[model samples]
Target chain A: MNAPPITTASAESPALPNRFDLTAAIKDGLKTALIMLGLSIPILAYKTDQSGGDLWLSPRWGLVAILCALVFGLRILLHAFMATKAAREATPSPHQATEFVHAEPNAFQKTSRFAIPFFLGVALAFPVIIYFIQGGLNESRYWVDLGILILTYVMLGWGLNIVVGLAGLLDLGYVAFYAVGAYSYALLSTTFGLSFWICLPLAGILAGFWGMILGFPVLRLRGDYLAIVTLAFGEIIRLVLINWTDLTNGGAGISSIPRATFFGLPFTSGEGGFAQTFGLEFNGMHRIIFLYYLILALALLTNFVTMRLRKLPVGRAWEALREDEIACRSLGINTTNVKLTAFAIGAMFGGFAGSFFAVRQGFVSPESFNFLESAIILAIVVLGGMGSQIGVAIAAIVLVGGPEILRNLTFLQAVFGSGFDPNEYRLLLFGAGMVAMMVWRPRGLISERSPTVILKERKAISGSLVKEGHG
Target chain B: MRWIQDPLLDVQHLTMRFGGLVAINDLSFKVGRGDITALIGPNGAGKTTVFNCITGFYKPTEGLIAMRKPDGSNLLLERLPGNSINWKAKVARTFQNIRLFSGMTLLENLLVAQHNPLMLSSGYTFLGILGLGGYRTAEKEAIEKAKFWLEKTRLIDRADDPAGDLPYGDQRRLEIARAMCTDPLLLCLDEPAAGLNPRESLELNNLLLSIRKDHGTSLLLIEHDMSVVMEISDHVVVLDYGTKIADGTPSEVKSDPRVIAAYLGVDDEEVEQVEAEIGV
Candidate 1:
């Protein structure tokens, strides 16, 4: 279930005068039904199929009728909802407004104090918890791998959050850095036989180098120009990977590159392996657990560094640049370098996550890093509220973990017809969720920002005041 | 006219052209150290253009805008790149449109202005992340400066509030305070009192006076409000059609017929007569 986003409105909305004219609501529904009819006639009412050189139309008027009815009913409900909301806002509740303002910051601190530790404990105990719940290693391995996947996304989200959320730079090619990191690690490990630990930092440095390379040419561009260029940058990286047969193996992908060792100790079942060293039975579960923990540690490191950076001068400069580049220059901040550092630092984290992906899969490929990955990561940051750190974490969990939960919605298939696939509805839900988020809370899930430094006491800034960044 | 005593900035023959359109054409002015200088002009008279050129926002086609540093060395503002005018020469400015980090707290807005010092102390964020740098001490000093400015601007109480949440008058004062955090030798303000009510602007006048008196920072402002221009300005420079028509003390410039004609407007025939009076 979605969390209630409007705490203040929830408390005061019932006090508003509630009125609905049945005739007006029915008229509104009738209009929507007419529109739905016009839309569904060609698409939903019939299926076009060609067989034996003949075109045929199979009518499905029942499906059309159900969809039209649903829309009409939903529209009526929406009209009433909008009416009540408008009425509530029309009433000037000065006392409630002041109380909400004073209470917000304290509420934030209290929730985070509880939430952060709870998340840490959940994360640290996740693999073990799943192992017990699923009854055995064989059954739980799927979930352990899913945990690693979610954490990878969480790390990527946090990394992109720095550029898009805090710095307000629209980068559509973040996956290029991830690809650079993965390829660097794969090449270094396979050619030179360097350890994962040795290649990790080098991979990050390589990705950061690429980040600056991409950053230099696009320094003057902003908003849409910046986005288009970055998008092209991502495509260029992908194309090179696909065509560069000598270096990248040309899209067939480099398999058997390497599996990560536990600090020079492999997780093999043989002698001197992790199982033999621990004097336990040889089970592949150890490696899954290790990978999960490894990514969890890495993701937490990203979060910790980002949190620390927010308090530093460089981070403040990024936020200031987001507000106004001219003002930043007036204040003596070298906007060029501030922007470059943001790109580089953000890319460095992406590089780390990319290399981790390669090591976990024991393979490297161009197909793994794509623009879709960058979009999902960017979407996570924006949905979390641009500059809110904890919000990013929660959003990553919902987006990445929500799909896993969706796989279990078999009951929905029973309720709807057998033709209805729960898996197919995920996309529909995603689209609906995004549209709803934009209309009701455009800023994000957790929009209010807590000031880093306070002279007296902390105060929560309303999301309406925050700029989501044009770029 | 008499020369400026202990001049802080001398801008000479500054010209800025956007392809064929000239925004500022061969304008010159001198801002005295520890004095409040006002640039008063009619709408579209290139007041902001001159300010932009001075602040290194726009590259003048031809100019010798020299900033006299505290060490008695002259640094050419025109040649210096964007931002070094503030970091190297200590010339800070505010926009006509308030450009505060509206989402950030008032304290953070001020802290960002002291980035030059704090960045070096933090080793450009590398050592600071590791907790191995002198950033802690530098940040304390920066915050102290911010607090001082906040108190001076009478915004200490709302230091934690977002800059955008403040009313128009407080936002203007916060912009100045944010500018002051850079420890500038000359602070350029563009229409700081444009949106403020009479009472709020009266407070702004007191704030600007206190800044000059207490910090001894040179103040250069572009203002349409004659009350603010005539009251606090040690010297006033009046511009018409991108040309300086009157450059003298406030009393002298206030009485100049050219200055009055530019503001009050004159017919096409009277324009030449007023121009002739200035001997251009």
Candidate 2:
């Protein structure tokens, strides 16, 4: 095999006898440059500019040419590097092809026993710690808000983790349930004058109902087909919200919905309000603190329920289904009920988070419940180990909080010209971050599974042992 | 002792066809209660198709698969769903390829076999999630049952290991252990000794013998290994081209002219001389 390849190479390229193929390198570079120019012309050559309330297209030919040149040069360099490396290791060992991509568990993975509790402790004290560090509630309000957002996403990630992670349903329209919950709360509270407490459970139930409705049609679907159907389901819900003028207010959004009161006491400055009843200085920080705690409690509830459920028979059925649907069926597991239960339970939690979002913002909008939210939540679940509760929390913090934290990096402006705002390149950095994370850890950050049921002693099972589902 | 009079499973003129391809054609056989029956066939002779029909994995196009329950009631297996055969009819089966829940612990795999009982005791997960006393008792009982089978399969020490991590022979035994944990009336094994060495085959023979003698579980095995077939089977049914050519005791099947011809790919006249020369 090795001899034939060498003979063929020598016969094809008699002119380049030394094997330093400069002409080939130039050909590859020119081809890449042309492809780059064709792709980048429409996207980079023209930019949308809004000046003094007027929108117009501005040409960026020089910038486009510079970017194309950079792409060409980079492609050439990469090809040359790869070619030289291949030449250096000409006789590849057979074992190299069969060897596993990852070795045994690393030091960090082994210490997950300590890492989980440490992360929990930090999460529990985050708002208080931020308050003390900022020296005042007013200064720490933004940090508290960001914390709430991250925690909300953590809760959502954990919620979707049941259906997609544990059951292996590949739900791309999970945000449809979130939207259902938001609309359920918004409509019930505004039309019927219901309290946030009354609307919370109602929203969850309605969202879960929608989840089953979507789940029923796609029960027979698997893998990419399931994903596509789910994605369509999400889009259908968003479109319905946008077009339904009578109920959802048609993208104008519902405002002044009502803030979440302290169980019946409103967070108002007037008499009989929470601030007055408690006899504290009527500051807005009280409501912020209450909302923060409310979401923290909700997130913890999601974690606790998932933890307890993992030990149950149904939970094992879900994991078994994820491992091998055919095997699960052969085991006499009622796969229909198992799948429906997973979707309903996962949707219920997403609904709870959605209602919380409405209460936190004091407004409801279709804009907040879009495909992007579903993508981010799904990303968090995958980046976190699929069924891991703590991994989801850490991933939410790093992926969501990381981008928000980048907004505070003023030093980046000095390094990359005065107009270089870090927030402007947030999505670019996000895509790059995702690529790097996948390259570094293909399985996930916390891929080890703590067996739901164990023998005399419980042990963490390696992710390599866990099947991520063929369906 | 009462079941000894009637067959545990009866298939009458069972036929399965996929589009225009007749996988099983006019097949009829019976599995005796508390007996190890071997179904031997050449490659693509539809031995697995017969197993599938009996186990309710495939609903035969034309057949009456009557399974005799403990109460002497007959279950129309072809009409029932695949899981109903496993759960209600108590007909459990292993696959040609090992299909143990690979990601789960060996104990967990066995425990999942007791899902129906545990789920019922737990009030369909309500009491289970609450960690109620009833659910706890049921779970403890399930773990005990799983441990029992794990011990029987000689995998008690590796109960915590993932099922996939076990060696091939151990995995085969674990599949049987998991099926036994389900409290099956009929255990159907497809190619259990396909890849086993001599020692492993001997161990598997002992395990199967113990299961039949100690537990009184009716076993229907589809096997290609002639030594395994000739050694352990009380009744042997030979199949060729999706039809039962011979059915008898081990010694009787070994000397049958059609069985010899089917296995050796010789004509009917040549089969007698071949069997006589081998002194079967």
Number of the predicted model whose lDDT against the real structure is largest = 1
Question: Of the candidates shown, which would achieve the greatest DockQ relative to the real structure?
Answer: 1
lDDT of 2 by residue, A235-326 (tens): 99999998998989989888888889999999899999999998987989889889988998999998998888888888888888888777
Place model 1 in a CAPRI quality band: medium
TM-score of chain B of each: 0.95, 0.93
DockQ, per-model, please?
A: 0.67, 0.50
Give the true-structure RMSD of model 2: 5.6
- Candidate 1 chain A lDDT trough over 10 residues, lowest sum: A100-109
Global Cα lDDT for candidate 1 = 0.88
lDDT of 1 at A37: 96
